[model samples]
Target: MRRFVIGDIHGGLKGLQQVLNRCNLKEEDKVIFLGDYVDGWSESEKVIDYLITLNGNQNCVFLRGNHDDLLLNYLKTNQFNKEWFQHGGESTIEAYQKVDSKTIQNHIEFLESLQDYYIDEANRLFIHAGFTNLKGVEFEYFKPLFYWDRTLWECALALNLNLNRDSVYYPNRLKLYQEIYIGHTPVTRIGITIPHNIANVWNLDTGAAFKGPLTILDIDSKEFWQSDPLHTLYPNERGRN
Candidate 1:
């Protein structure tokens, strides 16, 4: 069965739907979603609802994202963080206003049940963000780093491609996995509107929260599909731009 890795959705349910349809997934195919499923668009609640139903019909793996964590905290405690609101949380809060308490509770449970990271039998590491430990994810001291860290990506970007893996300057963390797939930080930040690879780390976030399209990459073939830019799909909304 083929394996597909999807980037952040950021409440762009239309974009999500488009890419999934384009993929033409089979029942046995594995699908891995690198979080940020909510916030930025008008359908955050609907996105979560769709995913909950999708899980039953598909072989799916969902990773936790920082935005997802913030929403979960607000749902569970009724405490709001100002930073989260400024960074697209307002859209999520607005979307949830019409949702029933039972639905909200179910969403909360789904959020809580998300995995911090997943390592397949092929030795490919899939995480929402980066792990800080040089020894690898199992030795990560800070749990939040799994969904919050950018240092790992930064290191991958900064590395000289010519450097030998056995060299003293080679990053120990990069040696831990055959390949690492992540989202969280959008590749659009670097002016890339598609999945980008730095060393063995592949960044799939094409910034659907802003001006770019949602992306899904075939892990084996490296072929990919994208939806129309989120701005075009939801012209009335500003998204997180």
Candidate 2:
């Protein structure tokens, strides 16, 4: 069975579906989502619903991203925090306008059920965002770091260039996993629009939340696919500012 890992979806159901369609998946294929499933686009609730349906048909691992966490927290405590709202969270709120409470709750439960990180048998680590502590993979870093930190990506960018497998010069987090796949820090920020590899850590977030497309990669084969950029798909919609 082909094992596929996808980057941030960001409520762009079209992007999500497009990437999946390109995967040529079978019943036994495994799909791992790196999170940020909600926010940015106009179908956050629909995106979550589709994911719930996919769970029954495939081996799916859902990891929570910062946007997914914001929605969950808002649903649980009734606090729609301003910061979250400012950052594509409003689209998620809008997406729930006509959605039934039960379905919304199911979506909430799905979000709550998401894992922080997943490590496969091959030791390939899947995390929404890389950890903050460059010192090591130890849990000394805060939880938010796992969902939001860009330091690991930055470190990977540097270490990968030097080709330094040396533990002393490179960060310890690099050595902890055989290979790392992460989302959250969109590749668009670097002015590139495709998945990028730095050392063993691959950044799959092609920025579906902004102008880049959603990306899916085969862990074993290294084959990859991408949806049209969200802007191209949505046309007039202003995806994640």
Highest TM-score among the candidates is held by which one? Answer: 1
Candidate 1 lDDT tens digits, 164-192: 99999999999999999999998888989
lDDT of 2 by residue, 1-241 (tens): 8999999998899999998988877889999999999999898888999999999889999998999899898777768978889899998888787888899789878988999888899888899997866554456458877788888888877674655577467677888889999998988888898889987899999989988999999999899999998889998789887
**Model 2: how far residue 87 lies from native, Å:** 1.1
What's the true lDDT of residue 81 in model 2? 79
- What TM value does model 1 have? 0.99
Give the whole-model CA lDDT for all candidates, comma-separated: 0.94, 0.87
Candidate 2 clashes: the total is 0
Q: Which candidate is the best by lDDT?
A: 1
Q: Which pairs of residues have clashing backbones in candidate 2?
A: none
